[model samples]
Target: MKSYDTIIIGAGMSGLAAGIRLAMFDKKVLILEKHTIAGGLNSFYARKGRKLDVGLHAMTNFAKKGERGKPLTKLLKQLRIPYSELALNEQHRSKVVFPNKELSFTNDLNIFTDEIISKFPHEKDGFMALLEDVRNFNEVSLENPYESAKERVSKFIDDECLREMIFCPLLIYGSAWEDDMDFSQFVIMFKSIFMEGFARPEGGVRRVITLLMKKYKELGGEIKFRSGVSEILTEDTKAKGVKLETGEVLLADKVLSSIGYPETVASIKEDLEVKPRVGKLSFTETILCYDKKPAELGIKDTIVFYNENDAYHYRKPKTLFDEKSAVVCLPNNFEIDDYSDGMIRLTFMANFDLWENLSEEEYKNEKNKVLEASKDIVRKLYPSIDMEPNFVDIFTPKTIKKFTSHHGGTVYGSIDKSRDGKTPVNGLYLIGTDQGFLGIVGAMLSGISMANLHCLMPAGAES
Candidate 1:
């Protein structure tokens, strides 16, 4: 059996990041991925000669200067990956259309504030106060559980509509939770997305994964695809190795699981004394529609938020699709182009259990129903464009579970600011969306944080 100093389960960004760092330290590392690809959520698939990303609509924290100087750029520099900026049009920076009125959010805070003031002059003070809260929340620096963030925003912003418009969508993007989510978790995301501009890689998010994989391989790290780990071997209540699906056992000194919190815990065979609440949490399901490119659809590079009103309402379990939701547009480019046929991608929150119960046949029918409903929502936003899409792909919680091996197919492993993020399990480290923070940047940062902790500990130190 092959052996190494450490074995990382999952080849997603967090796992790859951990491998790159460990390999750099001259430690032998092996990454086991169940899927054929390496990027996890960052990876993409090809259909009819075109590539479609599973998720990853856009990114922030890639900016080189100003607010971008924090974590993301620092990691890229360490990894020796080079990136360039992609500009957004001033007119369509970000548009949010509610039932009663419309608001435009720009990269420039002053421009964005002025636009909001123009539309709702009566609520200018309230709007400015809300912006101040977001800015303050973004500026504060704290450790993993951001206790200050939760306190600050709740104390300052009392208007439900304003909070719903400004912070609710961010909550959706961050944790599949609404605005009422823990403020500290929301603050980490706010700093990443708002302080930094929305960005895409030169090729796409897949390129980010490819770059990391190349670096990992160059550092002599090993990766085995289609080799799923069925169980984690343990001795004396400590992790020792992993058992693969093929009945092959490999030993290692340490094991880091980026597959998400629940699945990772389930893989551990030992009946450990300490068990944290990692498996129970909610998730956001995404549906993607692709085609040659819709004609006469004047799209922008911006993400559009569609809702009836901006009110922060905490959604109960299994009630994800009940509320008024936002539809995000992910197009090739924002500008009107005739050179090539275009494709539009739409994503929204969905019910996990609802989709998991459907059979293959039932899934196809339910997928059609979701597509039709989504199409109607999109048509209402962009009425000028035609509604016939060439292809439709729906991903439920089960899909995420099957592909990523995350418990409950949760986009993130576990909800943040909860007991899970701080739960101490000997020899088992948890990172990625399940640890609380979401988004590409958040996942990478979490991995880096865990790596740093591991690096500081003494040999055989309990983590």
Candidate 2:
């Protein structure tokens, strides 16, 4: 019968963020994680001495050190992390290849704008106007199910190509529901990525996770690894604490579920349960270790969104891969001091049901098919790389399910955008991807924001 002011589930980005906030406020906080280590999605796995960064490619909402009012700066302030310690590397540029056209955006807005104007001279007005709309777009909290990304953008822009292009990067970064994303979700993604651009941590995502863990521990917050909540303890319509799989009960004034909404609700022992209407959208990524250098191949950019002339559905694919872009990323391309053998990650959206019903042999066959196709695509994208992978590992939806226990193996969690973490059950809150924030930075912000409102606010004051 251990008691604390708060019990946070999962030690992922959001969970760690919430724990750090609670500890900073001098609240007795404890975080329980099922895995032995933290950074659930944005974690790494060692294979043959090379640490593979599993989920994080790059952090969105990029801001330079000491740049006030920016998302990155804001996060650093809340967590009390020094900007010099982060040592972020700005990406030179990123590519977005469409069926008939392509675009490139750089860390410099002038260069990004010039590139767009140079290519599509006639569509210059439309593109510039759209940028203004994106900057002035404050409709992040609008709750209209009938409105979608396509609905809002189409009102101002007339070009079908440019319209789809506007959604290309955002959908690839934060898509949860359908090809046409929820309008509010789109605004947040646009602000985080396009408006803010991207930056890479010096030691990658693990560095950020390590910093949060350190801050939480320094603040006297406790974290229990290999501990999982089997059931949520509730009585008289209010959550009391959690019952661990070890038959131990830890009481708390409130609980923050960073795992997910539906998954948390179903774990409650009471008759209260809510099922998630998932989009069946998931992903398959292949990590390849080659024997060549990126600079040797004349590869100027670190990442390429290679669309083989297909409109990005950004949702559940009909087949393994349809007319969509292959997200090809060179994780080691950032400005790290050391250089090693090449590591390339190729990912694409897929349907969970497409492989969920496979037999053992069927699953093997399907996995091989995707691997081979992906290898061919990698070679085609970089013809002069002299590619020879010493290690090739592919992770499908089954892997996602095994790691996160999410329905449909969905990495984006649920599709609901209006959920504000407050559930029908009192004293329970939801955060992370399910709470409508996407990517590593978004998840951390979601956790910190929700905790400040629901957990730290005054008894009679507005949250």
Candidate 3:
């Protein structure tokens, strides 16, 4: 018999943000989470006395306090959270390594531009033109049509190598499509990673989650952990409410789902006209803990996008995992080293179906291989790192599926994004990854934007 003004599904970045926004406006909001914990994908776990973060390397879209028009500033302002609470530390620098070429960049855009100009001297004008294009494009517009990023970027840059290098980090960090991403997504990632750059909260992602939870509760928002939604109850193609896995029904005037696009469709029994395909991209990450920090080992880079060949293969692997390419993150290389011990996280593209078909013992053996490969990559990148890690943990696509419940362990969600957040069913909306916004900042923005457009707008107002 109970009803809420709005019900937000999943306690991920987007869901929590939506709940907080709705509650701030005095709307009775309820957040239903399937797991006991919050921070659905970007969460943390304690294992053998060590706290490890999941799905966080470096938070992109870093901005200084009170920086005008920046994503980080806008996010905090919208959530009414203070920038000081985040305690963010900027990255020292990151690199993109492809065969004989290596380009280094920091929080400064000039450094990246200079690197490009220094290496690809002939393409400086083209690069600047591309940057202008990215700046002028209204990437956030809901009505914009999808265009191939590679094709568009090629018009600006002549050399294929420079283009591949440019896209290495952007594609791996945000794209749902293989090899390339939408032009709009490309611009978003470009500005966030290259222009604004990376930073990390002092306590990793947990601190951010804690702040949102505290803020939401203070605003009188309700969140039920372990309350899994079994079905989105609908009538006449309109959302009625939701049926929990426990067979309990809760009514809501509107529903916002952050789980994913395809997953959302699967929850409803009605044969809707739209059927979004699940994204094929997945990853396996190897976490290594060392007694000595990376700086002590003479490593200065915060993160490195590594590729053995000229081409960057940012897609699902045919094998268990792609060994030639990886995203190696040195957490200790940040401006401030908060961890007691050094840590390195290596992420490799993986095939979900291959990992899902393995036996228990086979899975264990495959994980060991991934760990060895990770160590090999470290040795290759840092030849001085000869000692074995004190602790090592590897997670495959199966782990991603088990924890986040994203089909195929898809990190970026469905390829068919609902840019406007509107579904075929009235009173239903999509946010987070499937909504086309990416990273921690993008996810929160998606939630806030959707909530404002759908629930907070005045009667008869345009969305």
Candidate 4:
């Protein structure tokens, strides 16, 4: 049997961050992961000769090296990574295209504001008022107890199209709730994506993951991949240790789980009746590799949020693909290098329950249908490009499940904020998106904060 001060479950971005933090305090920590590699949602896989990025399209909360107190800056500081060494490349512009109205966003908040004023002259005051609320938003409780994003946005903007355009990205990005997403989450996503904008590292998320792993190992943190926890051993309402699938028991003073909270509860030996909040929204991601670059092919824009109609109800579709909206990302547009080829990625929501009942052949058939439909949408969005993709890869919700064990294969963990990384059982804590964080930066922050509150706060003795 192995023992440590704290045992962290899952070696995703959050788990690795928390492990590094704990080990920084000289505490012995062991991170157990089911997969052979780390980076759960923000991971990548190889197909043929291409290195296709799995989940992350872009890193939000972008900040420059000298920028102080920003989330990315703080993350680098906490992890001891030099900001300059990060070498982030800022995005020029990204567009949200509705049927009737379109908005472009940039790294500078003022530019976005200026565009709002230029596009909607009459609603400029209302948009500015909404920005003020977003800037001043400080609800003490982490739980999202206020009205939904749609409800809150409408309070400021009378124009329905503007309101939908403003909140559409937020809903698709952070919201797992169908009808509406909480206002607190809205403010966070708004501040992160719009206020801070997005920037990609020199090599993308793979580099980020490599840096995290290196820092973790340097701090004497141990990570065991391909080792999944079968049960969370407990005694008297407190976590004792974990039993691996290989039947090895690794004891610890405390268990901090980066896995989904509900997944954690279900992992325990005790039959706790905790109702897990399966995320309402999941997605099917299709990657297409082309022999021609976007610049060469007459496509300049990097990311396009396309909504076929004026309605920006960013809810999960009842079918495989939401005909109303889809996000198309051109990877080659952002990179400044002389890379000869390009990659196009299409992402839209999916319903796992619908795919759950399909058989093997039927599953392939359904995914192919979604894939073909996504390509049609992409071609329509860029009618000028005559270049055909040389390679294509499609990942459905089932792929997400196989990798992350998210019950619904949800990209957004859950909408419930009250969980706040705590559980009914003592000596057990939850971190990561299921606790309300939505993106890579937020998830890392969640890990750091949870470590401070749970493990590194001291108060430990193990048997």
Better of 1 and 3 by lDDT: 3
Q: lDDT of candidate 3 vs native?
A: 0.95
Task: Write one digit per residue (lDDT tens) for candidate 2, span 227-291.
Answer: 98988889976999999999999999999998777788778877764666664668898888878
Q: What TM-score would each prediction reach against the true structure? A: 0.86, 0.95, 0.99, 0.95
What's the C-alpha lDDT at position 275 in model 1?
A: 48
The prediction achieving the highest TM-score against the true structure is 3
Over 1-463, each residue of candidate 3 has an lDDT whose tens digit, in order, gives 7899999999999999999999999999999999999998899998989888998899999999889999889889999999999999999999999999999999999999999999999999999999999999999999999999999999999999999999999999999999999999999999999999999999899999999999999999999999999999899999989999999999999999999999999999999999899999999999999989899978899999999988998989999999999999999888898898889999999999999999999999999999999999999999988889999999999999998899999999999999989999999999999999988999999999999999999866845
**Candidate number of the best lDDT:** 3
Per-prediction tally of clashes = 6, 0, 0, 0
Encode model 1's per-residue lDDT on 100-187: one tens digit a residue.
Answer: 7666654555665786678767667865675666666543233434344434564545544555566654666665443345566665
Give each model's whole-structure lDDT. 0.63, 0.79, 0.95, 0.81
Task: Give one digit per residue, the lDDT tens place, for model 4 in 1-463.
Answer: 7789899999888898889899999989999999999999889777786666787677888887768868888888887888766667777678899887779988889888988899899999899899899878773245446677777788899988787787777777777787577888888788888899877777777888988899999989999999999999998778999999999999998898877866787888776767676677888888877777777767777778888887876666878667568888877766453234677788888878888779999999987887788778878887766667788888888888899988788887765543457777788888887767668888888888788877766465211
Worst 10-residue lDDT window for candidate 2 reads 138-147
lDDT of 4: 0.81
Q: Which prediction has more favorable lDDT, 2 or 4?
A: 4
Off by over 4 Å in 2: 139-146, 320-324, 337-339
